[model samples]
Target: MKPLHLERCLRTVEADKAVLCSAARVPYYPLVVKKARGSWVEDADGNRYIDFLASAAAVNVGHCHPRVVEAVREQAEAFMSYTAVYMYHEPLVCLSEALCRITPGNFPKRVIYGLSGSDANDGAIKLARWTTGRSKIVAFQRSYHGSTYGALSLSSLSLPMRRRMGPFLPEVYHFPYPDTFRPPFSGTDEEIADYHLDLIRRAFADYIPGEEVAAVIIEPIQGDAGILVPPVSFMKGLRSLCNDHGILLIAEEVQQGFGRTGKWFGIEHFGIVPDAVILGKALGSGLPLSAIVAREDLMADWDAPAHCFTHAGNAVCCAAAYASVQVIEEEGLIARSEEMGNYLMERFRALQDSYPLIGDVRGKGLSIGVDLVKDGKTRERHGEAAAKICYQAWQKGLLLSFFSGSVLRIQPPLVITREEADRALEIIEEAMRDFLAGRISDEVLKTVKGW
Candidate 1:
């Protein structure tokens, strides 16, 4: 295959550097997208590639989906922005009702909208603190919530996100997240779960009493931390502990919700209902929208204007979100996610037998991770190799990204066809082969700073 020449893409990247803030960029490759539809994206230079990153797992229903596009178009034509804080809008109400219906909770639920995952998480913090009359919040290490102050305080995924920024929210605590593959404590799956849960239990008893903790925020499937999916016992034990202590359990479903995990939400896989669920990435099918679905009482106590954004429930964005939800249900994308996720995992596991670089394969549904390591036994992170694979895959006409230094995140849009997925798998293997054969060089990595 001829090597990709992204001249226009490179030029566009240069333009971005000249105009865009460095703080806003975390680019893995010079993939200057011109147009995207369904599972394919075309570059500025007219080169086409399969989209596996799904715009950082936000386009679950696919890019430019007709239903979502039409909803945006129609809503924009009627009116664009509305001060949802003070005004009533049909779209907002409709979207809220839909969220209440779909989210994992049998109890009465209410919805709060925001423009991104950051603000939604921020809102959840305020509500959790206010409702419980407690100040402390607990989050997992290597878990990402968002960049906003409250969310940032809860996040400890990478030091770069927090460097020189905090003095974060006081009383916010971090604990070990159970990682079965790289068990934080040396033991079996059950032992690992108990060990981590015991740490939290000990913290409640020795240091911060659970009574003082307002909430424990968690990602059902930690997205930015290399798609770390915790064991069921850990999650269940955490929930029980929260219940015993009266600390609210907030599920940050920003990246793993809306059928991306082969269910309505990732928490469903564990058969647990969180006190609140934070949603964002795919809620609007690529539009700027997020939501917090919580129990009615939790939302009721926190009155209006206390946590309101002027465009929190923007009519157009709500329309897009509503249509996006419909697309997931009508197109049966949730089930498709499970089926394709299994197929992709099977194929990747088969490839693992041939590639020592593949150290671990783990995830639920379409939210999978391919951990790369220098030595399989030692399990040392091979960020260099992961970067090379991503670069090679991009050059070979596939779009994807790596996170936590070395895990190849394999979350494509749920609408991806089997044929596209097979081709993507082939490109991934070819990239690995290219890396082992020295076709991908260290020089190629100088420009990209992937996380």
Candidate 2:
């Protein structure tokens, strides 16, 4: 079959049989992408899309970046795999050294590699438990760490992601996320911070002992749930609380790391150094690589052989990650992300002024989110409406992701130019306007909407 025909056939079959995620069958603009380069993807239908989603925040330096491609190619030609067990390779060592240099804090650090965000979180959990000789873990509600059993247990999202997946790994606890837009504590940022910290203190008194709590894992800037940026004092308070309780703080930077949030690591923005940092997604520029970087002393407890994986430090993946980091650093992508983020936020605020449905617009760097509501006063979630906006954007040759039902997340590649960003914003505005004007029927719009 011809490629286009093949894609159509595959999509048709997938629609019928695939038990897909909420966004999967929502009128896919084009079923297949033939190639991608420099912030755009060409579909099998001969249409091009500006990749605002960046393959769900993996292609930070742009899709198929030349340096990363070259690194992968070079490693593949020479050697593809080396067991981290018997022998060592240059790529793994160099990548670890580079990570030490870039990760926050002045303390000596150690690195552990994994294949994806889920595995990285798994490794982090083990490291925390082993180092502390404790079993309890604390996470926040509506936070998404990963989907594996271990990571999923640590995550506190709604059902199907965790429902009937129990009895989940025991002793994992959840706290309310610090959402300023919809404060779970019902007060100002400072009051919210105090309330959250008090809740943690109460948790120690009522549930897990503070000394037995392995770690308090959090996303510096919550993704998936929404681009929820906690107040600076809230984060610092959490850090201080962790220190006081003698619990390790693990910052999950899986989505917000690697210049996505205009910082080397999202935790850096809060000026707090976590005991361990979980990184993935953009680390390998779309290749599968994730890591746990922590203080050398903390990781030393995992000296035994049982803690390692067979493909822990795959050379090709490490090489790709090293090259991706180099591009982000040498090209000044962090600063660029900050600048583009500010420009996009400004545009979003302008949209907010004109559209009452835009209840919130918040984030840092290239990661931004617009939460839709029926009315700003009520803040009733317009999940269906947000999904329609995303579908319309996709139809207009711009790809974005929907999160937490009502949030339309805009996370373009760091390599996205100001011109490209403007074009994307234009498409978003057109979609929002069309949806608001009732140009599309409620039935069609509802089909695209997930609510």
Q: What is the C-alpha RMSD of each candidate to the true structure, in Å?
A: 1.0, 3.2
> Which one is best on lDDT?
1
Least accurate 10 contiguous residues by lDDT in model 1:
180-189
True-structure lDDT of candidate 1? 0.91
lDDT tens readout by residue for model 1, 1-451: 8867789988888989899999988878888889999999999989999999999899999999999999999999999987988779899999999999999888999988888999999898899988999999999999988899988998998888899987988988999898877886578888999999999999999999989999999998888888888889999999999999999999999999999989989999888889999999999888889889999999886877768888888999999999999999999999999999999999989999999899998887789999999998779999999898998898899997899999999999999999999999999999999999998879878866899
* Candidate 2: tens digits of C-alpha lDDT, residues 242-318: 89878999999999999999999899999999988999999888888899999999977677674577787799999
lDDT, residue 380, model 2: 84
Largest TM-score belongs to which candidate? 1
For model 2 the local lDDT of residue 182 reads 84
